[model samples]
Target chain A: MKRFRVLDIVLGILGLLTLLWIWHLVTMLELIPRVFLPSPAATIAALEWGLVNGDLLPQTLATINRMIQGWLLASLVAIAVGSLIGVSAIARAYIQPTLEFLRPLPASAIIPVAISIFGLNSSMVLGVVVFGAVWPTLLGTIHGFAHVEPRLVEVSRLLQMSRWEFIYKIGLPNAVPDILAGMRLSLTVALILAVVGELLTAQEGLGTAVLHAARSYRAADLYAGILLLGLIGLVSNYGLAIADKRILAWKN
Target chain B: MAQNAAIELKDVSLSFGSNEILTGIDMSVEPGEFVCVIGASGSGKTTLLRMIAGLLPPTTGAVLLHGKAVRSPTRRVAVVFQDYGRALLPWRRAYANVSLPLEASGMPANQRPARIRQLLAKVGLANHEDKFPGQLSGGMQQRLQIARSLAQEPDTLLMDEPFGALDAMTRQTLQDEVLRLVAERKTTVFFVTHDIEEALYLGDRVVALDSNPGRVAYDIKVPLPRPRDQLTTREHPEFLRLRREMFEIMNKIHA
Candidate 1:
């Protein structure tokens, strides 16, 4: 098993090298103008320079900060309110239809309303990020809490669990798998919204840097920004996956 | 008889909207007695057990526990469900699963480990406390459920076909284990099973419930000798006679 994992990682790196080779070939041949797509070396150079001298590190931090704040806020609220919607039939009847209707409304579409409310401030961007990232965890929490086994509920009842005890012991633990999956998904959504929010507000983040690079026709810088965002997504997701494995180890 | 009864159902009838599921059911169990109720699939044996556990309320009658009307589940009664897979939380280790009732009852966190260890030891799962329900075999999972039930420290225990899903050999061993455990505790037990021989093997008395509108068809006393061995008692002429009688009654209900 250990050897196979090493082999898998080696093959994955090889695949990445192949993609880079193809990208370099495309740029060298000028299939799409160099003005539009920079060579891999140029992109790599920009990345190095951005980290050493430019705002790359701080902008990356800013975007991550926004994502984490929005995600944490969304998760806390989801667990709280989602339990209500999950456990209470009356709450479900009233809130579920409204949620279903709102679930489909895109987060970007909320930007106009958010701008009207907060007027291009950092809070406006945070609002958009929260709006976008909240759905997956919220719905997942509700589904998880609602689907607890009937027999377990009977066991809980026979034990005479208080309402809080029932939710904590049975409801929350049952919802962990679903909630974790939702949290992973919401992480990606949060990153996207953070970037989008930064771009619209000219916030001091990678999104703003990318926008500035695009308008100035700095193709290498733009590509570098995109590359850095991809790396962020990959690393954050990997971190969450490790947490998921550790928390759900007993599942095995 | 009803005065000192541990559990009593007084003319209990259950209706679902317009559909009557159980009608005119009356039974009383003395403290520390093992009463096994057996019937076919739709016989409302499970419904009766649920009423005793206070999981459901009979539409027309009262389910009383220790002379008090059972409005809802009380901590004094523990239920071991048939679907051990669903009954035990898959996320929880065996120790935590058994700790559920203790946690609900607000046992001090520091005191829980010893109690949990003792309960797991009771069901022969002491070393398997770290295993998850999914990690354990079906029989082990059922034992985990039993251990968890024991943690409730109930005055009465209700089991709905608790061993129906286990293989025959496993079932026999668990039956013997349960009898020994019940012998130690003064807990009144209400066991429901479709298995005829199981009823005779486990119960001091077996109540056969009729289906459609479930009611007691016949209640027979099992005077088979105590400390019943699975091999010897199963071969006992009296055990065989009761088993045959139970089968005949169940067949009549099915017909």
Candidate 2:
């Protein structure tokens, strides 16, 4: 394990160096104008300027807060509804068609409808993100809950576990891996909707930053915003991966 | 006369959809009797055992435990399946697995620890109390399953090819342990297997079941005395004779 970690670190460093080298080459070649494709140094300067002068920190905070609210609310609703449907054939029969119909429709397509219904504010953005994120979570919860081993179910019945005990002990634990996988997918979907929501509807956040930089023809600022978003995505995914490993440590 | 029968199946018939698995099966297990049901694959041996365990309902007739009808798995009956890995809950420790039925029966939490310890020691898994099922070997896992079932202090123990997956040496050792344990506890056991030798070796009565609507082809009494050891029992003339007769019967059924 120690040797593998060392090798991983070395490979990561080499990959970073190669990326920097390519970035330098691309800038020097002037294949695209600097205003359209800024150098890494220029992008860094723009990032610093935004951090110092613009409403970057507050807007970033607002975006994160909205994302958390929407994501969490959607997750709770999905789990409750999905579990109900998973446990009951009639409930699934009634709800499945509606869910399937809505799931395939692009969440962005409903942004205009959200704006009209919730007004041109954070609620609209939240609506979009929640709509996009909930499907994966709901589907995952249903699939996970439904796929619990029949043998385990028999065991639970034989043991005379209460309804709640059956769910909490056998059902939930068995479905956890699937639930986590679904949440990971939902997180990515939430991030995408967050950016799209801000870009299309709001006057602030990282998405708005990209739009403003694009309008002003400031490529360096645009690249900086995009870089920050990418970093956020990488960090969120890494955090989830760590959590998944810890939770499923019992699994072979 | 009726008090001695731990379990009874009268004209028990079982079917899956249109295909009948067991038909007109009549059997009774006396108190503390070790009965082994042996047959070929697809022979309704397992189906019959499951009916007795109350895991499956008979298509027709009744499965009775202590004279009451068995519509579902009774608290006094417990089963140990062949797949030890799948039989145990992975999330629980060895001690927890043993105590699971006690807890389910709503045994007081304060008294659970003592019971778990006693059962673990009985199964020779005292040191493994803290270990999870995944950490145990195939043999150890089987022992854990046995411990868990025995913890229930059941009126009858139902095993479906319990040691069928183990190595020959491990299987032999476990068979000895099981016989010894059953003798000590005086627990009635209804064990099922495809191995003819295993049936003869462990059972007080070896029931040979034939397939195609499975029913008992023959019921042979094993004449070996109690507290029989592996070497001595195998060397006994009666044991050899019974084994050969069972092998022939099984072969004829298969053919």
Best by DockQ: 1
Compute the lDDT for candidate 1: 0.90
What lDDT tens digits, residue by residue, belong to model 2 across residues A1-252?
A: 779989997998799779867887898898778878898888888888877897667767666666677888888888877776776567767888888899999998898899899988878898889999899889888787788777787777666678677767776777788878888888888888888888887547888888988999989889888877877777888899989988887675
Per-residue lDDT for B1-255 in model 2, tens only?
Answer: 448478898998888899988888888888899999998888888778778877788889999987889888877888889988887878778988888888888899999999999888987899999888999999999999999888778878999999999999999999999999889879999999988888888999999899997988998889898777889988889999998898889889888
Candidate 2 achieves a global lDDT of: 0.85
Chain B in candidate 2 has what TM-score? Answer: 0.97
CAPRI category for model 1: high
Query: What is the lDDT, from 0 to 100, of the residue A158 in candidate 2?
Result: 67
> Candidate 2, which segments miss by more than 4 Å at Cα?
A1-9, A52-54, A89-94, B93-96, B108-110, B129-131
RMSD of each: 1.9, 2.5
Taken over the whole model, the C-alpha lDDT of each candidate is 0.90, 0.85
lDDT of 1 by residue, B206-238 (tens): 999998889889999999999999889999999
| CAPRI tier for the interface of model 2 | acceptable
iRMS of each prediction in angstroms?
A: 1.3, 1.5
